[model samples]
Target: MNDQYELLDSGNGKKLERYGDIILDRPCAQAVWAPRNPGLWETATASFDRVGGLNWEGRSKVSKAWNVEIAGVVMKLSATDFGHIGVFPETRSLWQWIRSALREQAQTKGRELKFLNLFAYSGGATLAAAQAGAQCCHLDASKGMVEWARENAKLNGLQDAPIRWIVDDVIKFLRREVKRGNRYDGILLDPPSFGRGKKGELYKIEDQLMTTLDLVHEVLSEDPAFVLLTSHTPGFSPIVLGNLLRQYHQSGTFECGEMLLTGKPGVNELPNGNWACWINTFS
Candidate 1:
């Protein structure tokens, strides 16, 4: 699998990265240190910052949309006002792990596994799970993002795959799934620190994450495969995520780590987020 994403260098609250043929300089709040490859930053085709609230420089240098293959999944990338491209490169490792876990579970159970992804931006994890032969449900609050994910699925020749693309509030959707007795063998979620739902329902991670996890637990099938939770919010460390999952699961093998943006030989690996996962032990 050819990964088209690379973090060339990062420091001084910014990260320089290459996505396919375009190089972008984006804000990285955690990169407080000096950049290692100072000279490499000059190659950035475009840059985004929040100095006066969300701004992009040299945007005309790049196309509006392009394709990038990361972790064997094809994604459509476009620069957004929020300083995010359609895909997040840090989750590449998580996508690979999801594929492996789902494949193992399907083989062991001799049945197709069901997977669910919440707050699924651009459907990278969903596509990975589908590629591993899992029936997937991809949900997000933004209709535009859901459509972008569908486009990505088409880009990967998975338009006809067993994927349920949904645009709804995460909490409301999960509740409906629970009521419908719909359960998944594996679940992946990347919740935002704060956001509004489809009906203007406010979601603050500090206030509602536990409730969200409780609802997620209700929708999980018995003898499940795994649960992966990742976050980019500051102060939400690996241990914080692991502890949150531990509250709902007691028997699984738990692991947590910093999600990194990795590059070639000399480039520094930047910790872009944190992830925690609980994997079931099958006999």
Candidate 2:
């Protein structure tokens, strides 16, 4: 739990969160229960919804961009038109896990680890890996996001870290990596339900996730260290992600759980998404 961020309360299709000094009320389709502390929500600085198209009320109260440190990584946050605040707080745990995993592998191998991150929005995982002494390649379809990630790296004083920021389609990038004989010890992906590549290439998760995983396997090192998969799309449960990874590596240690937005005592932990990870014990 980071002091810079907190999930104050959530329910009735919305969530109240505090990032640094700003409190935001945002849509949470999965928060079907009733809010525990309705009084706390009035303190929110801003709120976003999609009733009459995507919009944010009290937008003037929020700065154009702000910073928050979560899981030991500094992230730049902004109220985007798509309702994202540049960082996914639920993934904070994943970043910590990645850092620990890579640190352990680096010690065992006695060398830097090569890590790959797909759909690496804002570069939280990439920074976590870099901080753990891994050479990281962060790829996202949006150039703006790549630039945003770079800024975040600079904010953390990791601008000089061994990181390759690229804006491209995930599948195309992986295919090229495979062709060039580029291999990674660890890989992470957080694909969106629907997205477009830099070149207007459409991506539908249901139709392409298997193909994406296949390409991911091709770029993995012979002694891969780990693979982490997370998603916010409905029905893509932790088991579904575990089953997908199982198709490629059947012997690794598998861990799966729901990604949650949590706060201090008395605040209900909200399930934001799901995650599945496979770690190579023999590596």
Top of the candidates by lDDT: 2
- Give stretches of model 2 more than 4 Å off: none
* Per-candidate clash tally: 0, 0
TM-score of each: 0.98, 0.98
CA RMSD per model (angstroms): 1.0, 1.1
Predicted candidate 1 versus true structure: per-residue lDDT over 1-283, tens digit per residue: 7888888999999999999999999989889999998999999999999997889999998898989999999999998778788988899999999999899889998899999999998999999999999999999998889999999999999999999999889999989998999999999989999988888889999998988999999998987998999999999999999999999876869999999999998887899899999988853
TM-score of 1: 0.98
Distance (Å) between predicted and true CA of 2, model 1?
1.1
User: Model 1 misses residue 94 by how many Å?
Assistant: 0.3
- CA lDDT for candidate 2: 0.93
Error of 1 at 125 (Å): 0.4
